[model samples]
Target chain A: MSNKAKHWEKTKGQMIITMILWFFFGYVIFMFGENINSASFLGYPLAYYMCAQGSIIAFVVILFWSAGRQEKIDEEFGFTEKEDD
Target chain B: MFKGKFIDNLPKIYGTYTGGFLVFIILMAIAESAGMTKETIGILFVAFTVCIYAFIGWLSRTVQVDAYYVAGRQVPTVFNGMATAADWMSGASFVAMAGGIYFGGYTYMAFLVGWTGGYILVSSLLAPYLRKFGCYTVPDFIGTRYGGNFARFCAVCVLTLASFTYVTAQINATGTIAARALQIPFELGVWVGLISILLCSMLGGMRAVTWTQVAQYIVLIIAYLIPIFWISNKGGYGLFPHLMLGEEVARLGELEAQFGLVKNSAAAVKEAGVPGGLKSISLPHSEVPAGGMAAWKFISLALCMMVGTASLPHILMRYFTTPSVKAARKSVCWSLFFIALLYTSAPMLATLSKLSLMDPTLPTGIIGKEISAVMAIDWVSAWTAQKQAFIADFNGDGILQLNEWFMRGDVVVLSTPEIAGLPYVISGLVAAGGMAAAMSTADGLILAIANALSHDIYFKIIDPKADVRKRLIVARSLLVVIGAFGAYIASMRITGILGAVAWAFDFAMSGLFFPLVLGVWWKRATRQGAIAGMITGLGSGTAYLIYVYPKFMGNPAWLGIDHLRFGIIGASVCLIVMVVVSLMTPAPDSATQKMIDEVRIPSGKTILGKQH
Candidate 1:
């Protein structure tokens, strides 16, 4: 396979994984949160805590990680721009 | 220090600007302490802020097409991130999202989740690729990728429709802020909003809007964070509300249970008293639906919001202002961080505000001396006098039932300071921040619509050889016309702020999401498929919204999905249509395939055929 095609496939894989993680963090947690309302974290219902603040923290972390990972992939494939000093 | 003078001087310039703002705030505080009428203080605060934004707009004025179109492609990643956040967090976000949370409870998490999650798509799927394409507007991408004016025209139509809807909501938000702050009619407030937005955007285009948005971001974040911190500390949660919010949630939960009991009993008694009386009002947070169809509704709404955020034209336009593809990617992360700062704090603010409102010491429904006492509690009295909130004895038992207390969702953030008994100046600051949010978003939306009209419709289709000067004039003139139309729609107040914003997102996602995503990823996506997809998706979505859902399918939604989730259906139809049609049609030519390859690469140096 061409190097470009291989890189594309890898990027797609990474993206799918990231998206699945997001779906779990965002959707699954919210959808099933009520099931865990009895569970307490930091003095609140676990589900309610997720809705209030946990999911947001998860979102920020996911983005930062995804961004960092994407930058690494770009560098590996020589897709990033070179900085001039 | 020896390289570029502009880069060297950046911090100094920003420092001076920050210092000047602080001085101005101090002077304003002094004037307020000198006993200026609150109305006059509000007017001055708004006027001063708007003038500063206008001055920034004037400073960045440019006749060059490059600068006018994309801010000369020179904005640093961090500043662009700030600007993008300011542009993304509209009045709905700044003023209404928390209020929605306060009123709608867990169900409204659809907004918080959807909006923040959408940034992941932008960073991972859209921004870097679009930056690689190096386009001026979203239509430029469609026009170039599909290789025709027909595709361009369709994209322009979608852009205009989506942006017009979004801009009207923002103007409505601005009008709401102005009307409340200035004690004027909403119609007049909208007119004031239009003039200020036009002044900032009509002169310098994206260049001006970008700088002004960065400044606005500072004002808004400070405005948003201050009251939350104050209230959080007052609630004994300390300064870090996010860390301590769980306790607040627990307390709120207990209060809710107590109120729920009172509410149920009140409803039962009221039903026995008056057989046909309206339903007793429950605590605002008590209506969050749970399990089964409600969960499906939440999922669908969240999905629609996610895609809609990714697809909105004005938002996508913000990425084009960044200097490079790498910068674009970095900026998305920053935008999410900045936006999350406000999004997470909103729930804390809502909880704090709820606690204050439900204080047991406050006089409830008594008519004589107790009513006077309640009226004397600044926040309660202020909102009551304005008819934004009220307390009444519906059951006439002479005691205040928790269910009898009602507050408008939109005023929670605005009345936070008054509720906490913070000085009146902070109230003014929040108003200015709300105005900043509304104005910043409005400017971006207006520019998007005008750019589509002037660049896609006028320059590309009408006069291909139009000079730079003529193009700039057209863009400016279109801004004025669109601004006036937006103001008129806002004055009509057709829908609530969040409702209008939701429709804008749904429409954008329904029509543009599939096409834009496919354009970047699927090389075989034909022009015919794109055009068909755009038309079918938008047409069907609008049809369902206007006719089918409202007229034919009433009561329970089809498959537990309501009209608000129409984007899901529209997007599904679009993806199917595009893929099926593309498979049947001949593939795009080799050159078009090559252009797609370049778009996939992250480097900015990859040139496609020719510059526009």
Candidate 2:
């Protein structure tokens, strides 16, 4: 029961976040296709940076966020079997 | 940190270094034959690979049979992640992907989406269910879940078809790498690939494959990165610094006065044989419409890869090898992380090369350009005299334009290092890495096919009385046959490595992806539904590829559309069929429902079961 709860807690949030990010990414792609490079986030061409670098950064961020959250959930629910911490 | 593990395993690990020397000798002879002088580099790489493999072997040897198959239901997040990376890299991802980007341009990013998105289905939908069932193979899951021999047979057929198609592509890739790097004939290169795959995989079974793959993950990544670094430096982009902001982009924008500052900063992509000279920036699709696919086509291609990756039997089997649902998910993340490193570089390299290639005075590495060109034309004419050959005189002029040269997509990485005039050593290492990727995946897929035939089909259905030991023998025998058949298929197929590989993805996406995903995740999924889905999806995808694709592309009625697009259409059909049939058929029984619930159970339940 606890295991299911933990998974639901972690996965539900992740699913929502992932879907939102996916849509956001699609919009960015559409924006680039539209040839609209808005003002810079960090002095870089917003469209150019988003297409090339931004997607990768977002991917890494989501990966860490999801992995870390699951780990925490696993710990709270006593699901982990590994030694050490 | 390494002291306890190092001291305990020093003698055995040192013993494994002997095989390292053997691999070194094999590589050295090839390098020497190719006039490559990279002895130290080759030796170092071989040593690194052997050591990692030795470590994995040691780790697995400590586990029991159940653990050997699924890590004893105790794998942690990080280790599973590493193994997942190894599984995902295979030969195609490791070697051919960069080549696609290098040769195909921004359009090729579709492969990345196709490959990665497939995993979304795998992890979010199929993986946990498979884990709950505790089945070793896709066929095992189908047979157990559906409670029928016919379902198992269908699964075996799907597995065999997908694995065989995937393996042949790997063989072709291995042959290409070996022929180019080893300077041997294509036939001999295929033999080398066959021998290497058989020897590496035959020894310790899946145990050996997993360990070797983990080791290969490290070797291929390092090999992949070195060439990129060399090219970046040669083109005036320092490692980490320029990756953030490309120097080649700036250089191209500066060199082309029409584009002004953008000329030195923006990369210029030029066709090989175009005579009008370098364009400032990739002119809009209006100028190079043939060069880019429509956005709809691009999206479809990406969807194919995404769906295809999830469906591939070999990749799915790796998840079954992990201990728990959580471990499987963790592994997916790690695989993505590892793959992302290469995936990101592929586009960067392609863009940079485009910029560099635009320079009118760019070095071609030909000793004498005029003499070489005349000699090459004569060589082509002589070859054509002996046999029919196709050559397009694009510019009304009779002469073959220097820029008109289209490098085969498979040769992108090989030519990239050479294009930049990087040291011969880096080029040789890249070739070895490509070979490693191809060989490792080939071995795994061959093993999967063997298992599908012997364990899933022969022993389970045709001759249920066969003992475990006898089945093992059959499996080994089948491996040899499959390996030989792959070599024969590879010899007959003339399509280049990455192009052929995309077709393998299409087969998986259309034939297996939907069935696997829906069978596991959807309660209403039924045996009849799965069978119909697989057959129709695969049939439609294959027919479309063989017939409709060519027509859509406005080609002669035989030449197919790009295989990736077929994958998207195939996957969708399978998904639609599965849903429609599931609604019509009865839902799974109580036992199956329990199994599904078990898989979806949180990690907490897994630990609780351990306590019991």
Per-candidate iRMS values, in order, are 2.4, 5.3
Give, for candidate 2 chain B, the lowest lDDT window spanning 10 residues.
B283-292
Query: B1-612 in candidate 1: lDDT tens per residue?
Result: 234665456556666776777677678778888997888878777888888999988988998888898887778887888899999999988888777787667777677888888888887789888878878889888888887999999888888888898999999988888887777898999998888898888789999999899889888998899889987776577678777766667666666676563454655545544222222335344234667777777777878888998998888889987777888888888898898889988888877777666656433222222444665766667666776876666567555556665567777788778767776777888899999999999999999999988999899899999998999999999999999999998888677677668888888987899889999888899999999899898888877776535555555556865677778777888888889988889999999998888787776474532246
**TM-score for candidate 1, residues paired by index:** 0.93
Q: Could you tell me how far off, in angstroms, the CA of residue B179 lies in candidate 2 after the best superposition?
A: 2.5
CAPRI tier of model 2: acceptable
The model with the greatest lDDT is 1
Q: Which lDDT value does model 1 have at B380?
A: 68
Which pairs clash (backbone N, Cα, C closer than 3 Å) in model 1?
A: none
Regions of model 1 farther than 4 Å from truth: B1-4, B261-289, B361-372, B376-378, B548-556, B604-611
> Candidate 2 residues B1-612, lDDT tens each?
235654245345434644563466456546666775654554444334434555554554422333333434544455455456665666677665655554443455556655655555565556655765666667877776666788788778877877777788888877766665555687877876787677655545566666567556556666777677767666565655225444444444344343222221222222223222112232221111231234555555665666677777777777766656666766777766776776666656655555554454565322113433533653234423432222333343554333323334444565566557666566666766776677667867887778677766886688988765566567668888999999988878655555567777788778777677666557689888888888888888887777544434433332224544676667778888888987899888887776665655544343122211
Candidate 1 chain B, which ten residues in sequence have the lowest lDDT sum? B361-370
